[model samples]
Target: MITENQIHSLAKRWEIDQITVMREYLQILFLFYLYAQRKSDKIFFKGGTAIRFLFGSFRFSEDLDFTGTLESDEIIGLFNNACSDLNREIPAVEMENFKKKRNSIVSRIRYTPKPDTYPLGIHLEISIRERPITKAASHIETLLPVSPYPVVTHLESEEIMAEKIRALLKRAKGRDLFDLWYLLTKEVKLNWDMVKKKMEFYNDAATLTDLVSAVKAFNQKKLFDDLAKFLPRAQRKTIPGLKENILEKLGRFAVT
Candidate 1:
């Protein structure tokens, strides 16, 4: 359990706004509860959040994304237990709603610390149908600024980069492009072998040529619009040339 002052202090230290800090705090709390319930072993954390929390990507993520092989009933129990345990620390935390889709579970969580104010919502998406092709190296523990407990398990960086590549080919979101550019700039090598396995699972043919074609067809304007809000004022200057920069960096990976 964290107090409002603690959250504020963390936000100050990070030089980010309080809401962002609070959201991250809630994310940490959820991760703690999930691990405590022994659900961490069942699923491997992935997507932008994983990149941010585990690998130190600067971009902020709005939702928690994961993939695993767990039944609906079991996942629900995990969430129920997590929410119940979380409430002990922060009474305002609640599981607002959860819907079971064919291949995923979309859950809405509300955190409202103040009585008169509206609650902040965070979505947790669990892809139950697909499991990780490349397993994480281990359950690595990470410390956050706001929380004392460490986020226990996260997928490997190479695996995350591979998934980002897959997402770049499949989705038009700018964050995917931005994440790839950031990872590559940091010299994180893509696991081409794992990328092929993930592509096969999605029934998409994986090849350097195919990836290049996808990058060539990406909508630069749409990517800019989708990612504008998330970028800092200084970083926003690069948006005009982001498409070209991303395409250039992506070209390097096409052969290797």
Candidate 2:
């Protein structure tokens, strides 16, 4: 159990804003719960946001991505009806916020500000087709698939999401340096190898290649040097397989 004192110590020691970010995270989870209870006639495609809610970050996600399902049309989407059910001030709001698209990813978001410290926003994206599932790794623990969306699987555990996210941080470093640091410092790491293997299962070549690229940038900026100095004792105890291996890999890929 992470005690309050421990968290405070880690925050001050690591010089990271982990707890403040997590407080914001709980609000996003609330928004996801709003949609998961949907019973609309339209087939809504659910993926990234849901996965993030179930497994990913403890911070506000700027981009919400989704795909419309096998049976869907554009004229009238589920946007309005879902908001109406929730009594949002505006039935819905529309935006063209996606930076770019690859393979029919549709994003729709409506912000309904709550009377709270942090404003609450609702975002929905529908992918018309399902994401191509990577072959399952032996390490991944698969729960019984959700019947509504067989393609959607709860990552057997939180650790699974942590490791994959860590690897992703490395790959996405510098390109979106802020997101990388957020994932590394904020999320809990239970089983890094499982996360690493699960990512490999999804796309081995891309993951490995991106990993090299991300770490190189990390090294150039001495990111891990900062991490090594401040990682909490509890976190140090949990990241089992990746201690020297990850550090060595980071060294090898280090930019110099």
Candidate 3:
């Protein structure tokens, strides 16, 4: 619900484009809408988007990911009601292309915050495969001026790191690598036991050597291609050395 002037001002302040600012504002606005429903605690926020909004990662993410106990219908209901409230508050915003696979247990939607402009596409994935290892903690997100401080329910730093490690090992996406590097630079501790448990789910037996090899195998061009748009121009240079930096810091977590 920010004015055009406010969006431009925020773009200048954040050193990003107005389109990204608009997308992020709409994302925060949607999260606030969920908070307004008083069921925020039922879902545990995780992934790169959570890293950006909750932990202040420098990168931007396009999707909202969560692991929750809420049934699919309940989740959909909450989203539908939130979309109604959002459209009421900002008439320009529209929710479209909603679909939930019968078996994937994930829901997807797109939000166009402004007509005849870039549509802010958002994907919502809720995994109920297993319960979260750590209890959800409250994080008060107040970065954007789009809404008042909304407390988000999310996993602990260690648990988040564990999941990030699993994601890095499995997919090795630039975003996961960047998130892990950010967490490591911040000296966030890794819960090895939790890491192992998460790995077990994927049947991955990756060791320190395997993790090192995985980092080494990352294609720098792909890394840049994956993260360049999400990062500021100045920060794009850091992508080339992400693997080395991550390996240098990763050893501290070795269980030897």
Candidate 4:
């Protein structure tokens, strides 16, 4: 049960909406932060979670995602730690035996990480990532917007980094190609491989397939071409094999 007050209360801290921002705060802890924080050296939110700080909306998300560059066991420990800490604070977020892995089955740790009962019916989750260093453009940090309700301070850079892979997935094209046009060809380009490290919800097949579609859409619409005219195009084709690899996967809604 999610309530308007509780949701609104925390989101206000970051100058974001209770609906979108609050979900992000909770998502990071329960989903992946606990696992990453313990072992990883540096971890922060980057995807849609960052967008929410600037101009994010309240559309429901498939799950939460966080990114950091750390070994695998460390990532798992981060998830565990986050669960332990949150449950301690609120005392309602029960997270025991939260990890599961099999040969051909789902590898996930799904559980409630929020202590508040908002009455809004919003569940929280998180995804972790470690930014990769390659010969590419630097990632940009845009400011997020807050809801009409006022909080303590104005919208500022988040202490953590997370994103809305859910939106990116929905807006994908041929396979994993994201809607380049939608982002207006922003100066920053996402490193898919590093991003992959943090995203645990979807399997490699699902991630690649979705990414394939997103890129195809952008190319078809000449989104990159148009943006190249204005911006420096710092995000030049960085993700190797991304253009063709993910493009092979069909969209879930292809209606075979």
Candidate No. with top TM-score: 3
lDDT tens string, model 3, 1-256? 5788987887777778887887787777777787678665877888888888877888987888877677777776777777778778766665554466533255544555446766567777776665788765665565567546767788888888888888888888989889989998888886677888889876766666777788889899989899888897678888888889998898776542
C-alpha lDDT values of all predictions: 0.74, 0.37, 0.77, 0.37
Candidate 3 global CA lDDT score: 0.77
**What is the TM-score (0 to 1) of candidate 2?**
0.40
Candidate 3 displacement at residue 116 in angstroms: 4.1
Q: After best superposition, candidate 4 residue 48: deviation in angstroms?
A: 3.0
TM accuracy, model 1 = 0.85
**TM-score of model 3 relative to the true fold?**
0.90
In the range 93-192, model 4's lDDT, one tens digit per residue, is: 5433433233111123333345454422222232333242321112222222222221111112211211223344544322113322222233233434
For model 2, residues 1-31, the per-residue Cα lDDT tens digits are 2245654654555444544333223224323
Model 4 stretches with alpha carbons more than 4 Å out: 1-22, 28-39, 42-46, 53-62, 67-69, 96-131, 134-182, 189-256
Which segments of candidate 1 are over 4 A away from where they belong?
Answer: 1-15, 137-147, 254-256
For every model shown, the clashing-pair count is 0, 8, 0, 69
Considering lDDT, which of the candidate structures 1 and 3 is the better prediction for this target? 3
Q: lDDT at 89 for candidate 3?
A: 78
How far residue 95's Cα lies from its native spot in candidate 4, in Å, is 3.7
lDDT of 1 at 165: 84
TM-score of each: 0.85, 0.40, 0.90, 0.39
